[model samples]
Target: MCARSSLIAVIAALACTLPAAAQEPVKIGALLSISGPFASPSKDMLDGMQLALDHRDNKMGGRAATLILRDDQAKPELAVEAANRLIRGDRVDFITGAGLSNIMMAVYRPITSTETFLIGTNSGPAPVAGKDCSPYFISASWQNDQPAEVMGEYLTKKGVDDVFILAPNYQAGKDLLAGFKRTFKGKISGEVYTPLSQTDFSAEISRVRAANPKAVFVFYPGAWGVQWVKQYSQAGLQKKIPLYSSFTLDEVSIQAIGDASLGMFATAHWVGDINNPTNAKFVKDFRAKYGRAPSAYAAQGYDSIQLIGAAADALKGDLSDKNKIKAALREAKYSSVRGPYSYNTNNFPIQDFYLTNVEKRGDELVLNTVSKAVEKAKDVYAAECPMK
Candidate 1:
């Protein structure tokens, strides 16, 4: 009788120890440029992602979610290798991230073929929005070209013409200029493509001066933006050429450029100017936690995790049941930092964009909105997307 009673107790303990419904951690992988030219936004991305995870108590639905990360160093080859490790070795259920468009492009094909859901933290190239749209892939952020698309309309409305364009000589660089030209409806004085890592821009500045365009638009982000803007200011062209940019400067870049970045105008899909209560809390919490204001990149990174959690909760965190989880993701039912956000047919954001100017707000650099949300903003290739 004693032996039988002991066996019964052991069985009861085993039952209690078992996780509900065989719950295992839903694995996700992130490939970011944590230690390269893209480090500024990369840090923001990490913080934003972690903030969302913390908000969810580090669990999605009833199952724990695990995120494995690897730094791609902002290099194409490195991005591909990192994707390989995540997909083959770690066998992650999903993959996300890559700040630069070139690095995202390098890993695109391999990731799509893996049948793993790949979410973008940033970096949206045109091909993915159009022909490359896959059932397994979704963009948690706007396309690379969308910001430039908004800028194109803003410039056209402002009656600007004869603009000079500058970007790196790469696949994404070419796409960015093409994106601008697609909507501007103006004369182009010149379209110049500098090498991806060109440090000094004295020669390019000289050429731009000779061109004598009405305004100069650039797409340099991260460290490149700092160097380009610093040189542009020192060349004494800040006043001569009304500088406008898409992704040229942000909260992160402003610190690097210091007072030189003031008065520069840029456009984005998200910013601290969003007056929603949720965002107000995010800005306050983010500043308190990281000692800095969150950029759009950081905001989006934070939103993506919230998105995943909302979907998982709706589906009762049943990751093994793919259909239910995918349906929940499609619904996109969550209070986003952007206030209202939903996925287009191509699995990209169909949200609003804004025109923002750089300014010092009480000793802290901030993006001051000159215009409110430009509604119904669509990517240049939205028409090409069959899903639409």
Candidate 2:
């Protein structure tokens, strides 16, 4: 059988089994953009979640943990609708997995109003990590700005000043630029906000070239990242200037940009280069099953399910007891794939960051860690958060 079909069969077979008759089934909602630009990462995350579910013997805390999945199609309105459906129709105990920040924000009000706990699978916009943070909302991912903070610090330490910032003119984009600016501590040549769907970056490239910044930072993810990196390379600026970003480059983007993505720098929490026992099993199993290397997004998605299973175990698999589950999650004693991670006051991740490079690992494109964990890479708004 083909890889996709094989994967589907595996997940479908896993989905069919019952854990035990004793424990209540816990419903967890997953909203991912399965048919749009984020399809790859979204699928990557789903695959990870599936792997974790499989590893847990398809149960959480001895209870059968069921996933209520909806494809948002990368649209905010669709995401809101899906979230509402998950909450009202499916009656899920908790909601999780959003690939885009706009989608996450769209679901926020409804989720918060309904008093449901929403755990972020990915999207880490500033407000959700700051002023809009809620007691029930937990961002399993880092704050929107946290990963970029490492990039900023790296650039600063390298004495690279006079940098140009580029980001989509959206909330997350602004948050990314804000993050880079927060710790950069140098002369920002300019900050250019481009339209989210603006395809041609020729004008922006010309402007950036005119500014002659030492380095250029951008935060375009998925297809946008692919196009931007390709255009940046075509503009002949790759050899002339340094390009640094967080989400702008990754395994998926590397596949999109092909040889053009070589040598680009990105910062991430997890990289495939992590040669640890926990990650080794994950990497081996993923490769053996799919014949392709998994991305960090997949790693995180898988870890979230594993963490959920740990919570279930702690709660003794009582899926109906929401309070116990919440307490178990808060205790955060799980052996995470990204090492041990605990929730911050805002429920965002408090973990390490590694400077990664997009490179070929055998026949696969993977993020290789050049730097070890920059211990306790905290978000800048931690001090600003009222929770403390």
lDDT tens digits by residue: candidate 1, 1-388: 9999999999989988975443567677888899877788888888888877777778887888878889998889989999999999998777878777888889988988867777888888888888787766677788877787778778888899779999888766777788788879888898899987787889999999999999999988788889999999999998999888888788888988988889989988888878898898888889888888898888978887877777778877666665566677778588888788768877888888889998887887778888863786767666677864
User: lDDT (0-100) at residue 166 of candidate 2?
Assistant: 92
Candidate 2 yields a Cα-based lDDT of 0.80
Question: Against the true structure, whose lDDT is highest?
Answer: 1
TM-score of each: 0.93, 0.90
Q: lDDT for every model? A: 0.83, 0.80
lDDT of 2 by residue, 216-314 (tens): 999988778888989989999988988988987766679878877888889988887676788888888887877777788888788777667677687
